[model samples]
Target: MDFFSRQESARRATARMLVYMVVTVLLLFAAVNLVLYGCLWLVGHHALSRSVWWWHQWTPQAILGTFLLVAGGSLLEWFRLRDGGRTVAEMMGAIPVDYATRDLAERQLLNITEEMAIASGLPVPSVHVMKQESGINAFVAGLIPEKTVLVVTRGALDHLNRDELQGVVAHEFSHILNGDTRLNMRLLAALSGILAIGQLGGFLMRSLTGGYDGRQTRNPVTIVWIFGLALWLVGWLGLLQGRLIKAAVSREREILADASGLQFTRNPEGLAGALWKIREQGSWLSGLHAEEISHLCFGESLNMQRWLATHPPIDERIEALYPGYLARMRQRQKNPRPAAPTAPTPPSWNPEGTLGFASTTGRFAAPDKPLFASPSPDEPIPFDGVFSSGGLVGRIGELRMEDLESATWLHRQLPVEVTRALQTGTGAKAVLYALIARFQPMEPARLRALLADRASFASWVEQVGGQMQSLDARFALPVVELCLPRLALSDAGEVTGLLAELNVLAMDNDHLSVFEFALLKRVEQHLRPKPPLMQRHALESRLQPVAVLLHSLLAFSSHDEAAIARHHHQLMSELCPSPPAIPDHGLPPLEALDKALHQLRSLNPDGKRRLLDLCARAVESDGILHIREYELLRVIAGLLDCPVPLLQGVIHE
Candidate 1:
């Protein structure tokens, strides 16, 4: 399935999750009422079957209370999870890998994760190791890609080689890109209420049993006992339902993830070898919460009934990756063939030909070539401000090996000092400041002013300023991506200062450029509280905001107003029965456009794809995506919770 299909599947799983919770709530309500009626009868009020007074008076209260209890419990658990992936990582007994970790295995793990992240247009997620678990397994968790964490058992590090480890890490990245982590988070929250109910029942049984005295209504001991029994039963059933849902929705995804990860590495053995190791060594975890998060693992975390298993059996998964793979492996063991070489970046790799996009996708050949060739950073990135009337159009969804190699290669071109700087929290903050200073040099006075007041930031900017001056424009985004993990390590006040300074530097200019807005937005995505999970919003209702955004993109990049209007006409013609009036007042300012982008965040996943298609066709008519347009489009896609790695393979400095 494509991105839209993945989104629809997530929505379907969410619907099932809600349904399960509703049924559990209703069952609990009935159980509570039944216990009440039985107690009243035992206390000599009225016959249980004939009781109308209590039922009429308390039924509404009982349902209301049950709903509140479930909601309150869910809210509490959500607050606990506010830190996103970090919170979940801690629960799994994972210790974060230091950015400057000395161990070779941990360092390799960090490098592989970083390459895959940049290659896929993802934030470099924090890496953690489950030191206590010896299982050959790993999984990703978070509310969004920025806050996402990658957790691997110590066994994975010990048993897997570089390629095997990369295969496993790529599989986890697939979850972040596919929107599975958010789904897992939602499911975790939904199940919390049932878990709380079960725990409460267990606690009550233990606490009140001694007061029973063998009397039916002895100080309400009998009533508490019945209520606890019913709750325990409901909790048991809720747990059963959770497992069934996990099996139904989660099992099929394992195959897709395996295929997607292999596509990235293009080494079937790399992934298959990982699976072979798992089959022989097993992926079962000894963590206390293993059973609860089995659905989120790279392999099944528990040895359970076949029907309730969270992942497909290891043999079946290996077979999917390479049919009749056991014999191939046995033969290989006898012959002992060498591990495969990493794939090279194809000379012809471009947005048009790679990732299933039409051969004439956007541009004729090398993307970002001009920017890379510029002798110095003083020359600003180029923008033709011209679009094809016919629009660049084609089907696109998958990643190619060139994407990973090219992204990694481009990142490696960065000066070694800059990369080293990114390994520390203070240095990462300085890198952000240095990027702003270099790219928006016109606003250096304001930047200096903002940093001068904050002593720590001031020193950081001074330290990195020299090396970053020669940094290629193409590496700006990559460096920003690398800075995230380190920034994540910064203290709260320091990060807040960094963000505030960014705003101070950017806002001094009356109207921000699309580039500046995107630059700020990218950093803020990780530094700020994560955006809420995607919720469905109809295109019809969101047209105005979408138009506001489209207008900014069309007007800013195009010198011809007529071309802008024509493209807007095409977008509206496709969207509405009768087109709405275009803004005669000209493109909305950046602040208004920023608001418009935020408002459109609620667009359904399918709607997001459609809107993006409309937007791209409107501006990308030349079959080539220039750097300016790519910057604009990439940021917009990021806000929509979509991946825009199309330009990742473009050769750059």
Candidate 2:
């Protein structure tokens, strides 16, 4: 989906959740009111009275009190679950996850993650393993992108091997991508609120039964206390009802996650095999914390009443992914593929600027570069040309200007169908063409050149076409890196950063393999800028020593780590300081910065000052100033902000 559609879906989902909350709250409010009146009528022998005074004196206050109890309960549960999950991770200990320790199984997991993320255009999520649990399971947790976690069971990591694990993690990533994580978290919080009401009712009953202290009650008060006791009993019953509702919500989410995971990975057998192994192993060692997070896992983790199971049966899950999976399983007594290979180690990049530009001369280039020369100096770049030059344009407006005068109109006119097709296409070249076609009416000569150029577009077309026809059709995203040498060849930093962004985007929905990344460097050489020797040197010098230190602190440091780690983080922060991370609390500033970033990500350089003006907006998002969050935003701005000089260069031409 294009960015806006994803946002729209998220908004609609959130709105639905709010409606659910409103209806639930209103029902609870009415129910509490009934309980209050029923007690008053029963104890005082009062006739049914719906007097205004009765509401003012009792019902509203009781409803307000119940709301407080629910809110408090939710607060308690949120902290409890968050802390509990962390403790569980700690107890499991850190399973060694460096590049060196990964065997073929682990390597495959990482590569799949990279490929999906890049393909989907999102940040690469960090990977984690639950080293103890032998059951096949995985869960994603986190409220924000930076804090999100993907945890898999030991069985998933060790027992299933590479392909199966890829299927599992890919499934989890789908949940993260689909905005389900937020919904899942909200569901948990709301359930906590419901349970709190029951707890309050129980507490009142116990208090009445305990008998009031001599100093605390009069005869009349004692009589009222008797009514409280009856209400407490009803409250206890309500708790069970609340629990059932929570479980029902969780059960539906599991099935949805399963289907969505299949949609994302596009490999039914991979997920099916993982499920098969889970059933065969039959070692369901339920984690102590499973009850608290049962909703988040791949399978049923909670030992519910058989009727209250959160997940569909394992067989059902398998069949959904692979029709007649069991029948096929029976036929394949001999292993289908060679014994699963050992996980390969991730290669260490020489952090220095040594890596050469990959060439696209033969097998590696994408098939969709614009065939004709760039727009003539006197003419504006045509929208069609801009679309054809998908890899070239860094900003959205730069590609859209010829179509309309305003960005708003351009946003409205976006061709959703074309974008969708391009996004789902098998080859990057086809995707690139689709993206262009979506934005601008076709230009025959430009399309022809895009399809026919021997030295540039032709090779990419031939390779992508073949790949599309193959049994395992897949887009070669890294092939786009070949164009880096042609467009931003003179600036090594720009080329590296651009390639990294594309690489990250490719793996956004899947894992990016080191092989894919390496192969990209080779392709960029032949089809792009520089002599053969320069391309080779460019690839070799990529992992420079300085770059290694820069990335070491910049990319992975967590919020909690401090001292030297903190200093390195701070230094890295200073290196590219631009703006602060805005909390979700503020509005206008965030809205402006968001608009600016949208333009930048689209590759448009126009009106960048508008982005800088919104820096203050980001700083105030969370209501309170957090230095760390601010620093994070600053880091982002630094990376996306193009210097005035670069903009000036474009203008002068």
Candidate 3:
């Protein structure tokens, strides 16, 4: 499905859940009323006549009270989990994976995650390992891409080979891209509310029976006893309904994820093999809260009733991956045969007309030629003005085997020092400082004075500045992206301090260069603990703000006044047909541009697409797409939650 379809699916799932919740609440209301009527009737049996009507015992207040109780409980649980993916990860006892770890397996996991993030054009999610569990399971959790976290079991790392591990990781990434996490979290919250009803019943049963006090209450009518029993039974029924809902939603998504994983690796056997391993070994978790998140796991956490299994059965999943395997297995069972022993082959890197691939060894081989080469100025630019907003959204989390291969190639091509620096907080901070210094060099006297008080930080920056300057422009953003996870390890205060220092250094010359602004903005976007709330605005109402952004972008694209005016006119005609008076003032300051972009972000998805189309027009108006301009466009597209893979491909080509 495309991105738009996935989003629609999520909305539909939410609607379906609401229907289920309403039905559940109604059932609980009836059940509670029945129990209350029975209790009241028995309680008044000795004082009232036998002919007293049963309907007289029923009270609207009782039903209303029960409905309110269930609704309030569910809302409380949902609100508690609003913090999103991290809360779910903690519930599963997942610990963050250390970037500086020396463990080869963990290092491999980090490397694979990095490649996947780059290929998919997303910020790298935090990786967590469920060290306590020895189950071959993994999952992705988060309300959105930026807050997403990937969790895997220790057993998976221990048992799965590199190819199998990559398959599993890719499967989880599919959930992230497909917008499944938000739906999954919603299901979790809804189920939590239902379970609370059951728990309340259990508590009532225990209290009424005097199970906690070791003595029963002497209520001869047995009214309270029947009421407690009814509550307990109804509560379990709610639990059953929740499991069924989870099973229905999770089962279908698992199949889709399996297929998407194959698309990511271009190796069906990789995922099929992981499933086979899970079957042979076990995917059962020994944790206390395992069943609470059974639906979120890579495989079923409990050997639940077939109708309530969160994931489809292993044989069925494997069959979906490799059709006719089950028939072949049955035939083999009918006629037993000895397995043949084959010689093991060493993994070799192969690259033909297709993208490069390493054999099962999982080692990435450097390509014979650069995977991407810069297009010469005379090359025919691949500019297609027809923009499909849905198509672009679909590509947001989409990845092909070729993209993965390219990611591997890019990772290998990065400078060794750059790679090392990304593994530690101190080094990462220095790298950011050096990147800023490259754009805004300070005078010797000022530089000496700035260094006087901060000896170590200044020395590190000076040492890395020259190296960072010599690096290719294409690698600059990716290097900074790679450093983010480690930099994120610092406390919030430390990040604030770093941002302050960067601002000071960038403003040393009293102006923010385009590069400086883009770099700082991108860094701040990721480093902040939470993103600003996304507000929606109508397209017609946002015309002037859109024009301001386009004008600034056009001005930044070229120094030639004619080219700038030409692009501005084109944007105005296309985006603002009525043609507002063009502001004759020079380019807006960085702060104004930042505010304009932030406001533009409030536009709905379709509105954002139009804005991006205008951006594409502005960049290409000069007939030369400079690398800096291309990078700037990419940063903007990413912020807008639109992936411009086609435009990105043109630049890489």
| Predictions in order: lDDT | 0.71, 0.44, 0.71
Comparing 1 and 2 on TM-score, the stronger one: 1
Note the clash tally of each candidate.
Answer: 5, 84, 0
Q: Distance from true position, residue 458, model 3, in Å?
A: 2.4
Tens digit of per-residue lDDT, candidate 2, span 85-175: 3333443342523322324445445445544443333333445666777777777765533335566666676666545665676677666
**In terms of TM-score, how similar is model 2 to the real structure?**
0.47
Ranking by lDDT: 3, 1, 2
What are the runs in model 1 whose C-alpha is more than 4 Å off?
A: 23-72, 211-234, 330-397, 442-450, 453-463, 490-493, 507-513, 533-536, 576-589, 622-624, 646-653
Please tell me which predicted candidate would have the highest TM-score against the true structure.
Answer: 3
Judged by whole-model lDDT over C-alpha atoms, candidate 2 comes out at 0.44
Pitting candidate 2 against candidate 3, the one with the higher lDDT is: 3
- Which run of 10 residues does model 3 get worst, by summed lDDT? 341-350
CA displacement after TM-score superposition, residue 274 of candidate 1 (Å): 1.6
Q: Give the CA lDDT, 0 to 100, for residue 559 in model 2.
A: 35
TM-score pick, better of 1 and 3: 3
